[model samples]
Every structure is written in C-alpha cells, then in structure tokens.
Target chain A: MTYCVGLLLNEGMVFLSDTRTNAGIDNISTYRKLFVFEEPGERIIVIQTAGSLSVTQTVIAKLREADEDPDASPYPSIMQAPTMLRMVEIVGQVLSDVTADISAKVDRMSQSATASMIIGGQRKGGSPRLFLVYPEGNFIEATEDTPYLQIGEHKYGKPILDRVVTPETSLEDARKAVLLSMDSTLRSNLSVGMPLDLLTVLTDTCQVQHQTRIEANDAAFQEMSHAWSKALRESFTSVR
Target chain B: MTYCVGLLLNEGMVFLSDTRTNAGIDNISTYRKLFVFEEPGERIIVIQTAGSLSVTQTVIAKLREADEDPDASPYPSIMQAPTMLRMVEIVGQVLSDVTADISAKVDRMSQSATASMIIGGQRKGGSPRLFLVYPEGNFIEATEDTPYLQIGEHKYGKPILDRVVTPETSLEDARKAVLLSMDSTLRSNLSVGMPLDLLTVLTDTCQVQHQTRIEANDAAFQEMSHAWSKALRESFTSVR
Candidate 1:
C-alpha cells in the first residue's frame, strides 16, 4: 500500500515515502506518510509510515500531542527526547499502544489493523541513526554492515538495495538508490503510487538539509526511470 | 519455498525454477520442482511448482500415473491430451484434487497446505501455451500483454521481468531474463536458493529444445550474476 525507505550513510541519512493509501482497489487516495520533527541545530527526527491509515494517523497524532503539549501527554515528546534511540522508543510505544487499542475494538469482528515505521535522525551530540520499528513496538537499528531500512511493498525494491547499498554510499547515490528502488516498485505494484516525499538529513545538521516532492509526472524522475529501464535491458542483453 | 517462472515468447517458452525446499530454515534440501514430460515430436509439457511439498509431489505422482497407466486413470492421459489446454487442465485438476484431499485430512487440526503450478507446453499442430494453475484449479494464461508468470517469492524478481519480457523477446533473451530474475530472488530471499532448473521449448518443436541444471557455484552463472550486479550499480549511478 506504501513504500518508504531510509538509508544511513557516511554523508547523511536519506528518507523517501510514497503517498498512496487504499482501502481496496477502487478506494485509493493520496496521503503524506512522512513526518518531520526538527529543531534546526538541536535535533531532526524523520518518521515514514505504512499500513493501516487509522493506526498510522493515531500514532502521529499521539506523538504530536507530546510535541505540542508535552506536559499534558503521558510520554516525553519526540522533539524533546534525550536521544534518537529514545525518540524511536516513544514513537514505537505510541504505535504499539494505538494498534492495541484499535485491535481490541475490532477483534470481535475479526478485523485487525497495524502499522510499521522507519524512524531515523540525529541529535546534536550523536552520530546519525536509522531504525525500522515494528507494529509490536520492537525495532532494529541500521549498522555499518546493514545501513538501510525499508517498510511497505519492500520486496520488489530490495534486491537493488541489497546489492548496492553500504555505509559508505554517498547521500546523492543513496537518494538515487531509493528512487530507483521506488521506481521498480511503482512499475510492478499499482497499490503504491506517487507523488513521493523525499528528505535528506546531513550527518550533523539535526534538520532536513534538502527536501522535495517528486510528482507523478516530474520530468527528471520520468527521465531517470526511462533511462534505468533502457540501461537494464542493455545490461540484460550484454550479460550473456 | 521456491521461485518458478514461465515466459511465453514468440520464439517459444522459457521456464526456470530454483531447487531449494525447506520445511524450516534449518531443514533445507534440494528438490527438483521442475518436471518435464515429453513425447518427443508429439508433445512437450513442463510443470514448474511452488508451495507445499506434499501437495506438489502428490499432484506430480497422480499425473505420472495417468501418463504411465492410462487404463487405470479416471482422466485421459496428458500424453494423449488433444491440446496444450487439455494438458494444463489435467495438471490443474490433479493439483486441485490433491490439495482438497490433503487439506481435508489436515483441516481437523486447523492446518492446511496447498500448491500452485506453472504449466506450459506445445502439442503437435498447436501453438505454445503457458498457464498459471491455482490451488483452486482455476488458471490464467500468459498473453502478449503480460508474457510471464511467477510463483513463490516472486516480487524480488518481478520488476526485471515486467520491463524486459514480451511475446517478441528472443528465446535467447528469454532464458537470460529468467536467470537474472532468479538471481535477484536468490540474493534477496534465503528460502529461494541455488541449483536452478532451466528448460526451453522452441516454437513448433514438440519436445524440449534444451535443458540444464545450473549448479550453485557454476562458473558461467556466477559470472553473469556478478556482471549483472555491476551493471545495476553502474546503471543506478549513471541514471541521473
């Protein structure tokens, strides 16, 4: 239903998310799933979501309550969390709690909804970090050996990431990698559509360094997609 | 788990499948999921399977019994089937029956297993045909618009096939396409492993044109896989 990816690289962290959500084939709509929390020189936290809209929306709503009214919320705000790890824990806890609350209400009818997220950023004193948080509130961090995390329609785009991405990958290449990864996904699956949200957090900026929305018909994205197809066909022919 | 793909091309048909079968991660074994039944010069039929081992094995055994002992079979032998469509029907019927029988046995314990198959063939005087048979016995054919069908751990290998395969693609290219597709699946999923089975039936030839079992460390296969990875990484960099 969605495709979101994050890469923790030597240069910075790259995050991308597609905006399509659907209750069924005929009930598709666009919704921005990437949320950014920033304090320019203090910290930057990026959250990309996929799965149930209600679950994801509530997770964000709860996190924002902590952000906008820290004293009234039961948990510390992600923006004010002591570290990136702490911020991830709060987001995961919120997601886990929201999912449980909803599932409880719907369980009798055999309905279930849950969401997963990729949360990554940097605090002034720490190196950049990226994590993939599960619906159960557990999470795994990106390391030098595996510096990328993805949520939603992930398998279609995974081989490219697995084959090419590494800790030393430059932010520019990482952005391209995720786009190409998303490109493959878009072609194969109708459930994941565009426009896409993209943001880069330079290693120490603690805030988004560059951000843009890639529209469905964006000329540059289209050209890159066409070129990649051509290159792959050529490569396929040449491989033998 | 398995990864089996069948492509219907102008030149003929290309079928490829990985040999790995695992009851669990710790209990992996090599089992040929691709089976060929040819009455050379009369007909050539290939069945590539994915899903429950018990179900697939039973389906194949039943089909073989019909092929090898037509007098006792309730249905016409596939070897004597009037057309490629008839052959597909036989396979699908057997699969459906086997699945139902097995499921009924296990249903009491709340456990069930089913298998899906890709069957393609040519009968003398008829055109080459490819069909993806479901556990329910219903099937869909590969057409000019979508000339390839895949089963089991399919997503990782799908984008390439979507972009490169077509009715007009050469058999040579079709073979390469399926191998590379399998390569992507192999790199991304542990359940889909090496020692792949590849087979081709040239147009109008009522028998296998060529068949090979690619070993895990086969030199040429390894070289192509390496070159593909390099080409992909280069293509990613050069896309922009």
Candidate 2:
C-alpha cells in the first residue's frame, strides 16, 4: 500500500508520496513512488502512483521508453506533450493499457493489477494543473472548490485536508498541509511508511523548485510529526 | 450505514453513536443504534450497533422480549448475566443468531445481513469492560494499550482516538474525545449523521451516569464542532 497526496494551490502544486511497498507484512520494502519528468523551461510533469506496483512501474517504464525511442513521432511522451491535459491523457492511457495487459495474465489468480495516479505539472504557456488519473484511463482535474487529490490510505487523513485546504493557500502552507495529512495516515496505517518523497512545482516555472527525501529518522520530519501530535492533543484539550 | 465508538477508561466507559440509517443516498432515516439495559445498582449494559439495521433491530427486540418474558430463566438476559464477560457473550450470541437467521432468508439476493456491536458496561462487583462483538458470535476486548473500539466508517475518526484516548483518561475527556471523533466522521461521511446518542457508565455504579441525544442543530454540539474546526485550522497554521 502507498499514501500519496497532491495539492493544487495558487502559487504552485505540492506532491508527497510514501515509499513503503509490501507484498505482505513480512515483505515490506521501500520504493519511490514519485516520478519527475522535466524539460527545464519547457515543462515539468510529476506523477505519484498508488496501487499494484507492477502496473505503475510498467506504465512508467513505457512512458520513459517512448521518450527515448528514436522513431517516436506518433508516440506522445510526457516530455513532448503540448499541454498539461494532453500529458495527463497520455499518462492515463498508458496506465490503463498496462493494467489491462497485466491483469489479463493474472486473471486466473483473482488478482488485480490496477493502479491510480496523481499527475500534475505545467507547460510554459499554461497555468499549473493537477489531475487524479484513474486506472481505467479516466481522470478528474482539481478545481477551485476542491484543490487536493489523494489516493491510497486516504480516509484516515482526509478530514484535515477537507477542512484546511483551499486554492488560495500559499505553497508553504500547502506543503505543510500535505505533510501533516501524510503524518496522520502514517500513524494510523502500517502499510504506508517512510522515507517520503516531497516535491513542489512552482506555477509557470515548468521546473522542480524544491524536492527532498524524508527518511524514517529525519530530524525535521520527526519534529513536525511530534509538533502536530502535541498540537492535536492541546487542541482537543482546549476545545471545551 | 452507521458510526459507533466505545472507549474503556479507568474512570468508566464512554459510548457514542450516530443515528442515521440509509438504504441509499435518497432514502435516509434516523434510527437509534444505542440501547441501554440497566438493573440500576446491580448492572448497566450499553450496546452500540452498526450494519444491517434490520438485523440489529431484530436482535435488540428479541433481547428485550426475553427479558420481559414472565417465564424467562436458564436463558440469561443482559440484566441477569453473572459478569461483564458473560454479558458480552450473551449479546454476541444473540447478534450472531439474529444475523444468521435473517441472512439465511436473504442469501439468494447476495445481500449481507451482518451487523457488529460495541458493548460495554459494569456489573456490581466488576471493573468496566468493553468488547467489539463481531457478526460471527466472537468478540475482542479493548485493552489498556488500545482502549477504544469503532465500527462502520471508522477510519475518518480514528486518528484522533489513536492519539488522545487511553485507559487512564478522565470520563469528561473521554466523552469529549468520542464526540470529536464522531464529528470527524460526520463531516466526512454522508451515511453517518446527526441526532447522535451519547452515554457513559461509571465503574461499579451499575447505572448510566449521563446520556443525551444531540440533534442536527443542537447548540452545544454545533459550538463544539465549530470550536474544533477553528482549533484544527489554528493548529495547522501554527505547525512550522
């Protein structure tokens, strides 16, 4: 299982994903679920995936393959897509195709190879856009009314986001919101673990402004988690 | 659908449940999920249920009928149970029997007639006890390490309880904790709604210490909900 959240704010977009993946309780391993595709001033696309890892890895591998193919004129790569919507379409199509293909092979076992993704980024001329792409190749874009999208282990962390997030929120505040959201999920669910992948894409920049990996014992994350817990306790106590 | 939670604290026990039951989004109605059976000065038992309303209603009705039967003996009513453990067993057995009986009649439709319950109380000489009874006549007790049990649409309200509840928590704080937990669930899930039922049992008292029903527009509940939302926003803003 994984926990990934993407926030679309006026200043930019914030993306966060936990790295833990497990076949079972004893087979846990860390795998980065955040992928970044950049072309400097041209475009910057970030994808955070959750679900059957095999399907996501295959979809991503195919996307990267198309980007490097010498005869890739007809193939729509995330790097060469003309618009953010087109890029999302390409990613969604690839995800759907990969899942269908893999699921066909595993059908006899009653297993699913489906995966969902949160894809957000910008092209030079367009505004920053965020979308939650479904495993079936369908997707929904974030609007002013709902500026955040999350997949996997989502319910435990949702109330906070539902109450605190807005499109007008600053990037700094947005980052904190997503991190705290992830913190709540990490505490309640054992399948989602760290180190976490965090990234910010500033509007119009078409480049990654800041990115970092928060390890299990990272001091900053520890402090933030501790602070949030203490604050929550205090808040409950003060609420009459 | 329903949302019910029970906490076992050293001071006593706290139980809270939402009253909404829905056949579909268009068909929603209020039904009390909390039932109290007390032989004041001897025992006090509370049952909070979630799942197939019909099955729970039947189970509760049967229990009441048995208690009222002039010839009732040998078959233990909750009020006649020798201990809190026996009381939980009696309730679990009744719930399982009722569900199985109803499910057999509806099996062809592929619909489930399962319901779960959180039962907690104290007998005259016993300490407070809390159990989460499953649909299959089995149950698990809340321990010092994890003093709360929740059923139906539980995740949204879990993080708060995971952080704030303990065996040593005061009954006042415990009541507040469960209310806020219910508030979180109410905000996130349409299936769990107002006219919440809240009750508490003090250790060795063998009677309900407090009980109330909070309506949709109840002033005190509204104030608490508003205060919580404001405090959460402030906490989020204060987190560096």
Candidate 3:
C-alpha cells in the first residue's frame, strides 16, 4: 500500500509520496516511488507511483532509459515531448504496455501486475498541469474546481484535503496541507509509512524549485506532526 | 452504500447510521438502518447495518418476528438470549441464514447479497459490549484498546476517532466524536448521507437514554456542522 498526492494550484504544483512497499506484513521494505525528470528551462516532469512495485519501477526505468538515450526510440523522449499531454500519453502507454507484459507472465500464479501514477509538471510553452494516470493507459487532469490528485491508501487522508485545499491556496500552505494530510494517514493507517519525498516547482520555471526527503526522524516534520495532532484534539473539543 | 459506527465507552454506548441506500448513483432511496430492541430491565440490543439492503432488512425482520412472536422460532429469540454473547449469536445466526437465502437467489444474476453490522448493548447482569459481525456469520468484539466498531464507508471517518475516542471517554464526548466523525464521512463521500439516526444508552441501564432522528433540515445539527467546519478551518491554518 502507498499514499501519494499532487496538488495543482495558482502558485505552481506540489508532490509528496511515502517510501514504503510491502508484498506482505513480514516483507515490508522502503523504496523510492517519486521520480523527477528535468532539463532546466526546457521541461520538468515529476511522477509519483502506487501499486505493483515491479510495474511502477519498470515504467520509471523505461522512461529514464528513453530520457537518457534519445536514439533508443523513434519517438521523442519524456523531456522532448511537445506538451504535458503528450508526455502523459508516453508515460501512460509505457505503463499499460509494462502492465500487460508482466500480467501475462504472472497470470499462471494468479498474481496481479498493475500500477497507477500521478504526474505533474510543465514544459516550456505550456501551462502547468497535474494528472492521475490509470493502469489502462487512460488519465484525467486536475482542474480548478478539484485541483488535487491522490492515489493509494487515500481515504484516511482525504477529508483534510477536501476541507482545506483549493486552486488559490499558497505554495507554502499547499506544502503544509499535504504534510498534515499525510500526518492524518500515518496516524490512522500502518500501511503508509514515512521517509517521504516532498517536491515543489514554481509555475513556468520548468525547474525543480524545492525538494527534500523527509526522513522518519526529521525533527521539523515530527514537530509539525505532533503540533497538528495536539491542535486537532483541542479543536475537536471546541467544535460545538 | 452506508456508514454506521458504534462506540463502547465507560459511561455508555453510542450508535449512529446514515439513511441513504443506492444500487447505483441514479437509483437511491432513504431507509432506516438502525434498530433497537429493549425490555427496559432485562436487556438492550442496538444494530446498525451496511451492505445489501435485502440481507439486512430480512435479518431485522426475522429478529423482530422472533422477538414479538416467540412461537415462530425453535431457538431462543434475540430478546430471550441469556447474555450479550448469546444475543450476538442469535443475531449472527439470523444474519447468516438470511444472507445465504438471498445469495442463492441473487447468485444466478451475478449480484452481491452480502452485508455487515455493528451491534452494541448490555444485558442486566453483563457489562457493555460492542461487536462487528461480518458476512461469514463470525464476529469480533471491541476492546479497551479499540473501543469502537464501524461498518461500510468507514475509512474516511476513521482518523478522527483514532485521535479522539477511548474507553475513558465520556458518553457526551463520545456522542460528539461519532457525530463529527459522521460529518467527515458525509463531506467526503456521496454514498453516505442524511438524515441520520443517533442513539445512545447509558451503561448498566438496560435501556436507551437518548434517541433522536436527525432529519436533513435539522437546525441544531446544521449549526453544529457549520461550527465544526469553521473550527477545523481555523485549526488547520494555525497548526504551523
């Protein structure tokens, strides 16, 4: 299980994802699920993945292979796609192809081979965009009315997002919103664990502005998590 | 789809259920999902249900028949059960039987006929007890460590309960906790909606203490809902 959220707002975009992956309770392990692709001042793409680790990791690896070795394919690479929409098509096609390839091999044992992703970033002439890509090679973009996309272990953390986030929200507040939302999930669910990846890109810059790995023992994160819990308990008591 | 939660607290017990039922987004109806059976001084049983309406409604109807007309059953009826444990057996047996009867018919059409329930109450000689009954006719009681049970559309409402309620929580605060939890579910999900049925019983009383049908236009509930949203927004902004 995993939890990843991407917010598209007036200021820019925000992406956050947990690092935990598990085949079963005893086999839990930490794996990086957020990938960043960039050619400064040209194009920037951030992908957050959830579900079948084999499929997602392969998709990311394949994307990177195309990105680093442009001659390996006839089509343009992720960083060379004409627009965010075309880049999503490329990612989705790869995701669908990899899923089908793996499912055929694993079908004899009745194992699943599927994954989903949330992609958000910008290419030079296009405005910023955020999307939730499905395992079936289809996708949907986040719009002003609903400017956020979440995948995997999402319900426990959704109420806070539904209550607080919007298109006009500030970049700083968006960061806090996703963190607090993740805080609620971490407290309620054990499947989504810490050492999170947090990233932000300012609108039109086509570059990663701020990025950090929030380890489980990160003091600032721990303090904010504790403070949020204390504030929620206090606010609950005063609701009515 | 439905949302129903029951909490067992030191002071008493709380049970709440939404009234909406839908086969799909287009076909929805309002129906009562909470039922109470009490002999005032002998025993009390509260059942809140979710899942297939056919299974739940029949379970309730058969339990009622066994209670009101004792000659219809060969075994001890729900009201005549010797203990809270025995009462749960009676309810579980009826739920299982009804579900099996319905599933055999619905199976031919490739549709679901499964259901789940949360039951909490006390007999005159026993302590308060809460149990979640699954479709397989098995059940698990809530413990001091986890003093609440929820069925159907529960995850969105879970974080608040995890943070606020405990066995030491008071009955009044327990009511607020469940209501606010339900409010969160209502905001984030479309399948769970008003009007809601709210009921509470003081421990050892063998009877209900407060019961109310909160209609859609309910004024006090509306006011509390508004106040809660305001308090949460203010708290979210201040958490940093």
Candidate 4:
C-alpha cells in the first residue's frame, strides 16, 4: 500500500515515504505518512508509517495528543524524550497498545488494520539513530553494517539499497538512492503511488533540515525517471 | 523459497529459476526448479515451481507418468497436449489437485505451503504462450501488456522486469534482463539463493533453444553481479 525507507548515513539520516492509500482498485486517496515532531534545536523525530491507515493515524494522533497534553509528565512526548532510542521505545509502546486495543474490538478484522512505524532522528545531546518499530512493540536499530530500514512494499526497491547504501554515504546520495529505489517499485507495482514525502535530518542539528513533497509531475523526478530508463536500456544493450 | 521468471518474447520464451530450498536457515539445500518436457519438433513445455516442493514434485512426477503410460486416454500427457494453452491448463489442474491433497494434512502446520507454477511453451502449430498458475488451479496468461510471469520470491527482483521487460523484447535481451533481475534479488534476500536454471524456447521451434545452469562460481554470473553493483553505485551518484 506504501513504501517508506530510512537511511542512516554519516552526513545525516534520510526518510522517504509515498502518500498513496487504497482500499481497492477504484477507491484511492492520498495520506501523508511522515509525521515530524520537532522542538526546533532541542529535538526532531521523524516517524514514517505503513500498513493500515487507521492504526498508523490513530497512533500518530495519540502521539500528538501527548505532545499537546498539559498533564504530560516528565516523559512528556517524543519531543521531550531524552534520546532517540527512548523516543523509539515510546512510539513502539504506543503503537503496540493501540494495536492491541483495536484488535480486541475488531478481532479478525484487526488484521486489515495493523500498522508498523520507522522512527529515526536525533535528540539534542544524543547521536543520530534509526529504528524499525514492529506492530508487536519490538524494534531494531540500524548499525554501520546495515544502515537502512525499509517498510511497506520494500522488496521491489531493495536491490539498489543493498548495492549502494552504507553508513558513510552522504545525505544527498542516500536521498537519491531511495528515490530511485522507489521509482523502480512505482513503475512495476500499481499498489504503490506518489506524491512522496522526503525529509532530511542533520545529525546533532536536531531540527528539520529539509522537507519536500514530490508530486506526480515534478520535473526533477521526471528527468531522473527518463535518465534511468535510458541508462538501463544502454546498459542492457551494451552487456552483450 | 525461490525466484523464477518466465518471459514470452518475440524472439522466444525465456525461463529462469533459482534452486535454493530451506526448511530453515540451517537446513538449506539445492533442488532444481525448472522441468522441461519436449517432443522435439512436436512441442516443448517448461514448468517452474515455487512453494511446497513436495506438491510440485508430485505434480511433475504425475505428468511424467502420464507421458509414459500406454493406456493414457484422450487427455494424455503434456507431450500429447493439443496446444500450449492446454498444457498450461493440465499443469494448473495437477498443481491444484496435488496441493489440495497435501494441504489437508499440512494445512495445520502452514497454510502457505501450497505451490504455484509458471508454465510456458510452444506447440508445433501454435505461438508461444505463458501462464501463471495459482494454488487453486486457476491461471492467467501473459499478454502483450504484461509479458512476464514470476513465482516464489518475486518482488525482490521485480524492478528490473518493470523497467526493462516487454513482449516485443528480443530473446537475447530478455535473457540478460532476467539474469540481472535474479542477480538483484540474490544480493538482497537470504531465502532466494543460487545455482540458477535458465531455459529459452523459440517460437514454432518446438524445442529448447538454450538452457543454462548457472553455478555459484560461474564466471559470467560473477562478472554480471559485480558490474551491476558498480552500475548501481554510478547511477546513484550520477542522479541529481
């Protein structure tokens, strides 16, 4: 239904998510899946979600509620979490709790409404980190050996990541790698579509650095798409 | 787990499959997935299987038995099938029957242990045809709009197919396209592994024109793999 990728590189972290959601072939809508929680220079946490829109939207709404809560305690919200790891844990717990509560209400129907999240960012005093949070509330951190996490329709777009992505990769290059990866998938499978959400987080900067929405007719993307088609044709022909 | 692709192209039909099978990560083993039946100038049919190996093996064994039986009726065997479409239908029916019989026993253990198949070939008087047979015995044909069929771990290798494949594609180029497609999946997914079976069927020739068993250390494959990795990096860097 969606494709989201988060890359942890030396220069910073890159997050990309597509905004297409559909219940069937004819019933499709656009929904932003990337949620940014920021306190300017203090902290900036970006969460990209996939799977059931209901579960993801609810979990995000609850997070926003916590952020706006006057009775919020020392833990407060993602904006106040001491470290990226703790912020991920809090998000995971919220997601799992919501999934369970909903599961109890709908039983079998809950299968169609389960969701997962990819949370990545930096707190003011901590190092940059990225996590893939499961619906079960467990999470895995990205390390130097595997510096990227993909959620949603990940398989079609994974080859490029395996070949070209690394922890030492620059933020700009990482962004391009993910976009091209998504481009390959978008062309192949109709389940994933765009207007895409892309965000770049500069480590330790702890603020939203760059955020852009790539629409269907975006000129830059069209050029990149054409170039890719040309390169593949040339490469395929030249390969004997 | 496996990766198999069957393409019906203008020059011919190309079929590629990986031979990796595993009960778990520790119990990996090799079993060929491509089975070819040819009456030389009369017809040639290649069947690629993915899912429960038992079901597929049984289906293949039954087809072979029918071919060898003297009293076999009007239905006969793949070798006696009137057309490529009939051959695919027979394969689909056998697959569904075998799967249903075993599934009654294994259903409790794993619901997804049922098998699926990609059957494609040519009869003496007919054009090349390809069908994707489902677990339930239903099947869909490859058309001009979508000329390739893939089974098993298909998604990891689908981007290359989406980007480069077509019905009008030459057999030479389609072969290379599929190998590169498999290469991409082999690099990223652990479940799909090596020693690939590639088969090509030329239209109206009624015999296998080319078949390759690409071993793990095969020089050409290794070169292609390395080149693909380098190309992806170059492409990523070059993308603005």
Report candidate 1's fraction of native contacts.
0.88
Instruction: Provide the clashing-pair count of each candidate structure.
Output: 0, 0, 0, 0
Q: What is the lDDT of residue A191 in candidate 2?
A: 98
Query: What is the CAPRI rating of model 4's predicted complex?
Result: medium
lDDT of 2 by residue, A1-240 (tens): 899999999888999999999998999999999999999888889999999989999888888987888376345778888888888999888988889999999997987778999999998888889999999999999999999999989999899999989998998888888899999999999999999999998888989999999999999889989999999999999998
lDDT of 3 by residue, B79-112 (tens): 8887889889888888888899999999899986
TM-score of chain B of each: 0.98, 0.96, 0.97, 0.95
Q: Candidate 4: which stretches are off by over 4 Å?
A: A70-76, A108-111, B70-75, B108-112
Clashing pairs in 4: none
Stretches of candidate 2 above 4 Å error?
Answer: A70-75, B70-75
Candidate 4 lDDT tens digits, B20-59: 9988799999999999998899888889999888888998
Pairs clashing within candidate 3: none
Worst 10 residues of 2 chain B by lDDT: B70-79
Interface root-mean-square deviation, candidate 2: 0.5
What's candidate 3's i-RMS value? 0.9
Root-mean-square deviation of candidate 3 = 1.2
TM-score-superior candidate, 1 or 4 = 1
User: Cα lDDT of all candidates, in order?
Assistant: 0.92, 0.90, 0.92, 0.86
lDDT per residue for candidate 1 within A1-240, as digits (tens), equals 899999999999999999999998999999999999888988898999999999999999989899999889997898888878888999989999999999998898898898999999889998888999999999999999989999999999999899889988888888889999999999999999999999999988888899999999899999989999999987887787
